[model samples]
Target: MNDSEKISILSKLISFKSVNGHEKAIAEYLQELLNKYGIESEIVPVSDDRADLVAEIGSGTPVLAVSGHMDVVDVELANWKTDPFTMTEIDGKLYGRGSTDMKSGLAALVIALIELKQSNTPINGTIRLLATAGEEVGQAGAELLQKKGYMENVDTLLIGEPSGYRAVYANKGELDITIKSKGKAAHSSMPALGNNAVQHLINVLNKIQASIKGYMDIKNDVLGGTVFNIDVINGGTQPNAIPGSAEAVLNIRTIPEFDNKKIIDLIQSEIDQYNNSTNGNISMEIGMEIIAIIGNVNSKIIDLIKTIAQPYMSKIKYTPEQIKVAEKQSELTGMPFSTTEIKTMGVSGGTDASKFLIDQPNNANYVVFGPGENNAHQDNEYVTKEMYFDFIEIYKKIFVEFFK
Candidate 1:
């Protein structure tokens, strides 16, 4: 397919107001796109409004599966200069809500796969595309696909998240826990009669703060640790009545050394201790868990991906704005001029790859590479034309090489 064809496909995808909870329409769009080329696909239902697209080409060994999320983050109309759903190319960047965070990646994959089918290449193995839903929320689509054994036979997995065309071999995992407290409610005038759930929750928070070091002390070489956020806390409603129920949520990004299971164990242990000591009516439940993905540095696929992305890296010039904090930190420095370094590193965010690892599905080496920008979930998200077009070529080249 030509560049214009690729852009048109992407525009159609972006036109759907997928937002977060709505992905079924886009999944239907892709199913029709595949049907045009006589390519067979199945729509894996995730919810009433969400579904995953799984399309495959060719037959036999060393399966290479390309995976990506279909759902994009919700957009703020006031923050965008243009319609967030309209795919517009200005200067060379394609601006849209999912343009970078990854409609482009999935579009590229679709184009490459369809083109390969039309080329009539002698098939030796399978090439699959798993376009998932709910990756931004909790990876529900991927979880269902894995449970149904979609990833069981795959030999390699490529996560097409926005990586500025970098070959990301590792990324941090995520664990979301909801802690609830229960107590008696009473009118504010009779303060001594009611046991405040808010107070109970506060006591539990203090225990976590005082004892659990979390990821503060732990660190990873590529994907550094130190993400422990008490993101949500809710307790009393009316000022006149003491709260009988309260809940708080915790988000932790885990590395290989410190994983989701271990983190949950630590939190459970803390809750147990708190309960035993003070009769703290606190109970905790897991909201979500995404395992950290790490691939061997010496893997042949990593080297191949790095080699393929070298020429494109020079054309990409995106760097996230650094936030200057009060703490003493390393000084900012610029990159070397005329350098030939390939963008091969780790990311600190979590992807749907984590959910695929729950059952230990084959030894599929998962790597994330896409035409994404760092300004994801922000206003005016976009993907450079160069990154999007080059990734199509990259995907094509990798498939040919891997099959050969």
Candidate 2:
């Protein structure tokens, strides 16, 4: 397929506002797109409006899967220079909501699958396109797909996360904890008639803070051990009344060292101590937990990525142990691709791989390698035309070279 044709698919994908709860429509579109190319897909319902898509070509184990979320984050309309859903080309950048975040990467992967099938080359292993839903808000889709045995026998998986031409092998995990404090409500004028949930929550927060204070002192080798933030809080209704219940949502970035389970255990200990010491009615529940593990440095997936990517390197700084595979390039001659916008962009809290690789073999390899910038949740997200086109070629080559 040509550049314009590929971009057209991306444009169509962006047109669907497949936000956290609205993934079913986009899933259907992708299924139809694959069907047009004689590739049939199954859309597994994730919710009333969300679904996960699985399409396969070729056969057998040692499967190679191109996976990504079909959903994008919500857009802040006022901040965009242009429409966030409409594909707009200013200079060389294709501006849209999911353009850089992942839709472009998904588009490229889908196109690669299409072209690979068209090529009729003997693929020794199965090539699957596993598109997930609700990756932005929750991991229900990934967990469901995993339970359905979709990740079984997959030897190599490529995630369509925003990493430009470079391959990002490791990332921190995300664990969301919601601490709830319940108490009796009474009028503020009454001195000791009521127990304040807000006050109880304050005590809980203090204990939580003290318990995990030194977590980052001894960090993991890749992406640190833990970095946490309180993202949401809900409590109290009126100033004149003592609150009956309060809850705080804490989002933690975790590594293999200070993982989700350990963190949960520590917090649960604190909750237990508080409950026993002050007869506090505080309780903790996990909102969501995404697992984290350092990618296998010497895996065959990374090795082949390094192999095909070596010739594309103009000025390189990657090795076997390193994660960032290669720098961006222009054709074979090469030119500096501007990464000033991406340098300021934040990383994903976690990818679908965090859940998809749940019970898979330890030798199963995966890489976050795809086109576009890292401006995932930022306004006016975009991907350059060159990066999009180049990755389509790169993915096509990777698919062919893998079984050879």
| Candidate achieving the largest TM-score | 1
Model 1 Cα lDDT, one tens digit per residue, 276-392: 887458999998778777765555667778777787766654343322320112221111122246555666678888887665522347788777766688899888887788888
Best by lDDT: 1
- TM-score of each candidate? 0.88, 0.87
Writing each residue's lDDT as its tens digit, candidate 2 over 31-105 gives: 999999899999999989989999998898678888988888899999999999899999989999999879988
RMSD of each: 3.7, 6.0
* C-alpha positional error of residue 34 in candidate 2 after TM-score superposition, expressed in Å: 1.2
Show model 2 residue runs off by greater than 4 Å: 310-348, 360-363
